[model samples]
Target: MRRGMRPLLALAVTLGASTVAHAHSVHAGLSADGRLVVSAAPAAGLTRFDPHARSPPHRLPSAGGTESTVSVLIDHAAMESGLAPSLLRAVVQQESAFNPAAVSRAGAAGLMQLMPGTARRFGVHDRFDPAQNLRGGAAYLAWLLRHFNHDTDLALAAYNAGEGSVHRHGNQIPPFAETQAYVRSVRRYEAQWIRKLRAE
Candidate 1:
């Protein structure tokens, strides 16, 4: 584990996947019902094809309050990786707003916007798989947080602009506007989720 090491490359992959749910038009959640449910981005989240392998039931976590079928999966993934569920939710919000089928213009895929190389490094063969995507993203985030001494800001900055940029700027958040905004946005989401958890 390289602490505070600069990341020169985006965790990227070149494989093409469905930008939105394309297998079938239904809620492909972690349930035995096999009912496809899109929470926020319906058109962008619903699947046209059936995603087999029923998702694990939504288990309520200690902090995130009552979890939805969709949310429970993310919360569990974060918790399994020794992370705060709220923080990971914030990242998912920023990355793809929990859209497992999302694909960024930069080729970042799945819910976490994982780049091709990064996806492979994280063992995410199917970026569109929500479970796999969330697991991989949480793993990467945990690694980054450790590398940055638990400095959420620095870790997020590195996550957005690559750790290399942080190192180049003397182990601080880079000056890139996109990276700066991204860090701020993620933190804001983090705070929001934290508050939500407390209220719950």
Candidate 2:
């Protein structure tokens, strides 16, 4: 408010220790090799935002980094399993937001969120290994697609909530809210990935 106090206030703002600043930066997106990458300085702080943007902005960065290595792996795995890479990316996005080490409270681990049993079932010895994880996830997704007669929605639901849930629901999408939301989110992300591919 006064001339003498201005320098301290300016320093506080510059150091991001003021009421309106953050001290760290968040870096996320894809690697040059097409592998998704995300890291935040442990000190990174959150900021308030405008809730009424015309288009809801991304809470976190997305795939523009285009990790080529990940892309290559997904392409090979998806093709071998007869699934689309774009769709696979969508699933990965939903499962872990591309965080290969991400683990859920339910004990699902890795980018595809493979539960311990599921990882073992798929012969994935290391769920944190992106290649192995994607391979297992892609294989399971292909199986689910086939089991559900190629119904994308049903297959996605099965991935999110388990095939048993889909079966209990008469092979339709399970009626659980989380499952439904997961399916929708995957589809939305899948479409975006598809568009990105086309643009490229």
Candidate 3:
């Protein structure tokens, strides 16, 4: 395997999948051969591998208290899902404060606070798993960005209040106080991330 295949292969191994295929580099299932194969972005020069079997239950990795490891995973998810690194960082910060096991009162779970339905839509079998959750959330965010024409505010509003709610309100941010606050918070965090990057 080429060095370019290392990232995908590592991801597959992390998920305990012998052969993993993702339409959008989010989750993994299995394949026929025992060797791990991953389908990543074509730009990465990774070959496509279709999995023939179901993946086993994932063994959850420790996200650790310092949050350093989670940050790396966030960067990876952002790259794979075509999301801005700052935006993903902000979303994760606002969503779960880097806590992989975090669960919301509204039933959102993991580092990105993914709802059950959203998680399933992104092929995330374990919501509390940081890697899976970040990838799933990043994929959803990327789709939202495209759906709303790369309007960060609108996409974030849709993330908080659902795309239907945004559409129902004429593609604008909804009037709900909580949703508004959520968008504001994410934006604030995003700004901070941007400043941090600039300073670096």
Candidate 2 per-residue lDDT over residues 25-55, each given as its tens digit: 3333333554433343222222222111222
Model 3: per-residue Cα lDDT at residue 26: 29
C-alpha RMSD values across all candidates: 11.4, 13.6, 10.8
lDDT of 3 by residue, 23-113 (tens): 3232332344435444444323232322222232221232223245456677789999998889998988888776554667777877788
TM-score for each candidate, following the candidate numbering: 0.70, 0.67, 0.68
The numbered model that scores best in TM-score is: 1
User: How high is the CA lDDT of each candidate model?
Assistant: 0.64, 0.66, 0.70
Task: Find the 10 residues in a row with the least total lDDT in model 2.
Answer: 48-57
TM-score for candidate 2? 0.67
lDDT of 1 by residue, 1-200 (tens): 12101110101110122423344433222223433233323344232222322332222122222123247567668888888988898888888655455666677876678888888998988876767888898899898999999998998998888888899999998988899999999989999999987877
Instruction: Please give the range of 10 consecutive residues that has the lowest summed lDDT in model 1.
Output: 5-14
Arranged by lDDT, best first: 3, 2, 1
- How well does candidate 2 score on lDDT at residue 111? 61
Candidate 2 ranges beyond 4 A from true positions: 1-69
Error of 3 at 113 (Å): 0.7
77: Cα error in model 2, Å: 1.3
Residue 72 in candidate 3 has what lDDT? 68
